[model samples]
Target: MTETALLPGPAVVASPGDFPDWSQAASHAATRVPDAAVTATWRALNYLCAAQLYLNDNVLPARPLRVADVKEVPSGHWGVCPPVNFMLAHLGPLTAGRPPGSEVLVVHGAGHAGPSALAHAYLTKTLTLTGNGPGWSAADMRALAAGFPHTRAYGGEITPLIPGVRYTGGQLGPALAVAQGMVLDAPHRLVVALLGDGELETGAAAAAWTGQRALLGSGLHGAVLPVVLANGLRMGGPSILSGLDEDELRAYFTGLGYEPFLHDGSDVAGFRTVLAEVFARLRPLGVARPQPVLVLTMPKGATGPEQVAGRRIAGTPAVHKTPLKDPARNREEFAALAAWLASYEPAELFTDRGQPSDLVRQALPDPAPRPRPAPPVEPLTVRGEQAWPLVSAVIRERAAAGSFRLFSPDEAASNRLRLAVSGDGMPEWASEILNEEICHAWLQGYTETGRDALLATYEAFAAVNTSLLVQHLKHRSTRTVTGAGGLPNINYLITSLGWRNTYSHQNPGLVSAMLETENPTVHVFTPADTTRAAAILTVMLTGRDRANFLIADKHHTFTFPPDTIREELTNGAAIWPHLSNPGPGAPDLVLASAGDVAARELSAAADQIAAARPDTRIQYVHINDLTVLGQPDTWPAALPDDTFARLFPAGVPVLLATVTQAPAARALLAARGETARVRVVGYRDPGRPLPAADLLELCGMSATALTAQALSMVKEPR
Candidate 1:
């Protein structure tokens, strides 16, 4: 194979290549492909997508499409495209000579800039390689352009279904942290994340900035090269990062412990040179700790029309979206679009078959196959009285295997996980960061990179990453549905009960919110004791492609033996026959409970009810999986009607004591069409510190409250 030259020759007069570069100058040129010509073609494709809105591979002949071809709603942003194109152009060379199985995973932070990314994918024949049911031909390219922003075809943002795309956009800030996680423990891979200036202002992004400290000290095998697209605009206005000068940008990143690299995105050759040097120094093996590199590149709308309707679009907020697209009644703008597309000279860049020309293909790298994850290892089992020992045992086992990581907001030791600390007393497999947001990013990144990890935080503080968790759940669930592949389990251990804290720390509302999303992959577990918690966690650790939320109190708690635990895991609920004081035939009232403290209270409530009303007869039920209460259609864990009938009986009054707010339990009962007969007593934020029993009573969670509520319901009607 011949070595491809880095730069093409200068453009002669009267040639199509005579177009000016991003700097808008002919003198600033490179020796390989002309920057202006490439950027023009890139802009043309972007304009085509914006103008046509909805075209497919079936669209005939690849000339400039007409405004009549436009869809009713043209989606996708134009402003973010230029910088994406510029980044892709510079990125091409980095992957050209990479060894087999080694890949440069590009995490597109600016997801709406899909048009520019698709254009790059098409130009390099990457789209062809990863495309489904489509050959690498000119017709396919046109179809891809046309079908974009359409769900049937590729849509506005990158999804797991797309080949070579590991990250999704649209959600702004997680990509940076995601990129960091993608490269973890994978010595052969490098993740180049392109972040939008607008996304940098998000709270998630801020979390990633601080999370970098954990990443640096993590002893990771891979590195992240974050390229900030410092374009002047976001969607409709100037971005926060756009206001900061280069010196300030450098200082900010430097203060965050990164070595900042500044590059004018308009200067193609300069960026290429700078990129090569950075890759050379950082990409090599044995760099002690892998320090991240942040490049500040300004290339606002570098490929869109410089001016439209006598108003400047490039380098302004106007360029953020389609600038020359009005299929309805704007013929002048349509005509301008035609001229702009003509300048790219698409015919010269692609063959008649819609495939990239040989010259262009030579400049791009072959899309490497997606990496496969290792199979899950066996789970740890502990038939013990304490939950932390079981959790610590697994952490140690996984840490030895070099695939486990734990992130906490400085509560590991307090949570009885002291055994997981290192020789120097630092957490070995866990990092005790004080920021929940940062810990959330670390956990997200680590799991996204194909590792089995856990994020342990106080139940209330978990809200800090609620949006982040939702986005990830979306990404993972999509992959599962699309038959792409399974995502590694993303486990969240929420401990430190609200009963132990004042109202300020009692926020288990995320459970209700998560359940409401109706995400099929979600499994909410409320372990009633250490034995049950161990059983649930073991399954979670060994599970595949599911988002498991394991809620348990960190304090030492009573535990059942191993056999009972197994029975509980299988049934999703357990019946303590010995503890039941039901009457001869069917019980008059069924007392069911979930969560540790709540269940314990219910047990005591059962005894009191039996003592107070000997003829009442009570059946005691303990639920570990909250989903069991949902209708079968909504929850596979739900009991069959016959089983449910046996547990609660048709008209027997049911009293459910739960750890979450009462509404969540009500929602579950409503889903099962049993709302009329069941009464739930759960957390109500008692507002001040009190004894556990006092708090429970204040929140209508005490055995006394539960017993009283059950009697009222039973005595009310026929």
Candidate 2:
């Protein structure tokens, strides 16, 4: 075996003599050789999968199986392994002829089947060839086997740690949506998302089927190949789709704008033939209009042990994980595990060096190199005083460049942002779906692939996609550790806050949920005015590898000086000198506010407080980014202790008004070890519809309440 020199960074370019052009030869050989090579590869993958879960040593057993070879605590799912392995085997040959500069990315919806991904990665030499892990030799295989579920080199599920895996679908339902986003506007890319039938029950997955409707008029090139790995069992019981026959399954998918292709795995050769044909038809540039879906139905735990301890396991949920619970301690279970491991005949598929044999090697495709990012585009020239206008300007520029998209849950007009239109009078670069999950998925997928996108939704409803956002945060974090180039930030324009909305539309939990993560990459920007919102929006668009939540108001609000807001954006918070009384070392009180509406009330309170007590020295501080209030160790954007002291002097009574729950601000302050006597006022949700001002008054966020609170705090003894 030759050592393949990997590129310096995440991008792995192939060297001259690294990978032989085996596609042509393999294509010609396929005419005469029955699908034996593919079968061999699949068998090898199955053996590796089982080995990862059960074996701690003797990876390629040459003697009689013994209990010493089994792991003390075998773990990992087995039900979805065989089918995933089967798909990888067929995909290798099918993707061999893909055009240059194209990619065949796979998203494992059933992420619990991590063993399958690891096995495939090892077999194809992806881990070694790409420099993501150790070399694919006998020693490395033994080390990997010993590591089992605790390897630092790989995660427990499909993760960025794996060379070929991009999206981690441990939280089911986003796989299809993420895949759709990846293929949007990318014509040469073919993203195959392997989804379990159980995952289809998720609301996100159910809504993802309608994503095609959003891309109908958009002249994008790439297509998603949804491969439904129907094993007929969920985590605990039979899957809902298991009751549907072939005809029903076809109709179900066909109704959702897909050309459905059903493959019954009973006949391996027949299924392989159909899979190859489908791949060939969908790999072309323009053939993915309607998109293609392959519903491959196989039994759960297809090639694993059929029975353990005299209980049927295969085709049942019992085989979901570690079919033989204690293979190392129980003699009967150990024998069954040994038989299962022997069924794949590891000796025939691997050489004495533990490397994949010639037959298995010939069946896998060369690992695709990571795509280099497109050259940086010039920053868009945006000019506006209002939040919506500023956001719209950025959108228009992105739409014109054909690289920016906006996914909104039918709130573009409501948010006062004009949707861009193409020459054909259709919405261009803007997709409006009523489902927040779908909108979030599209934006996530698009941005993760290096494109720019933003998801706009009402503030109250933004929490609906909190789970998706968290998953993406984890994905970006893992990708960063892998040295993969930074992806565009996942930006969410959270507008129409609960302050001005009716009873049912009042909720600020999204802001709190994101703040709770305390993730360095999570930023919550609560710009005090429209000018600040525009400046922050521009920065958010250009930022990388962070999740930004921009909470603003669509209605006309106060405007601040552009330069002042620019400076505020940089420091995350700044004292408005013009709105405060200039005095000595420390002011008698510090009045702080975040959010446009909250700032308006604070500004009014400052004027009243000044008139009432002319001699009282007061400082007005406007917080543009809420994350800055936290400790710098937890959030990079957090204000430093020195800067914080300068803006918020010690022992100065501070009255803070925010748009989110009061506890959120208190938590950040506590994290920063702030000793200032501070009283926080924010949304408490009156629980029913009321006038905006009345609601603010009830929540103790009105100007009168803030003024009274500030006066009492200032009058109190130091």
The clash tally of candidate 2 reads 3
* TM-score of structure candidate 2: 0.93
On lDDT, the candidate that comes out on top is 2
lDDT of each: 0.66, 0.77
* 1-718 per-residue lDDT for model 2 (tens digits): 0001111112222331122222433354356335888889889988888888888788888788888888888888888888888888877765665544455667778778788878887886766522345567777677666776745767656777776666666467878887778767666556778888888998988888876676666654465778998889998889999999888998998888777889867776888666655654463222335667899887878888777767888877787887888878888888888888888888899987888888887778765554667555566666743555776676676677756788899888888887654242336577888989888888877887778888889999998988877777777777777787578888999999898888898888987988998878888888887667776777787777788999988884677655577668788999897788948767899999989888989999999999999888999999988889999889898998899988888888888899999889889999877635888899996867899889989998889988888899889976
Models, CA RMSD each:
7.7, 4.5
Q: In candidate 1, what are the lDDT values of residues 1-718, reduced to their tens digit?
A: 0001122121111232121111111122234445554454444445444433444332333555666555545556777666666666555545655433344667777767666656655554455433465366655665676666647545566665554454555467777777666555555556677788777888777777666665444553555677787876777778788788888988888887666788876566666656655665453212334444656566676655777678776677766666655633576666665565556565666667766655555445444443445667677655443555776665555666657777788887767665444453654456766777667666666666567788888989887777777877777765665565565688888888787776688889888888887777777898778767766877887677777888888874666444456656887787777567776887777888788888778877778877888777778788888888888887777888887787778877788888888898799789878888788888887666777768878888777887788788768774
What RMSD does model 2 have? 4.5
- Candidate 1 Cα outliers beyond 4 Å, as residue runs: 1-73, 99-101, 121-132, 283-296, 383-387, 421-424, 560-563, 687-692
Q: How far is candidate 1 from the true structure (C-alpha RMSD, Å)?
A: 7.7
TM-score of each: 0.89, 0.93
Worst 10 residues of 1 by lDDT: 1-10
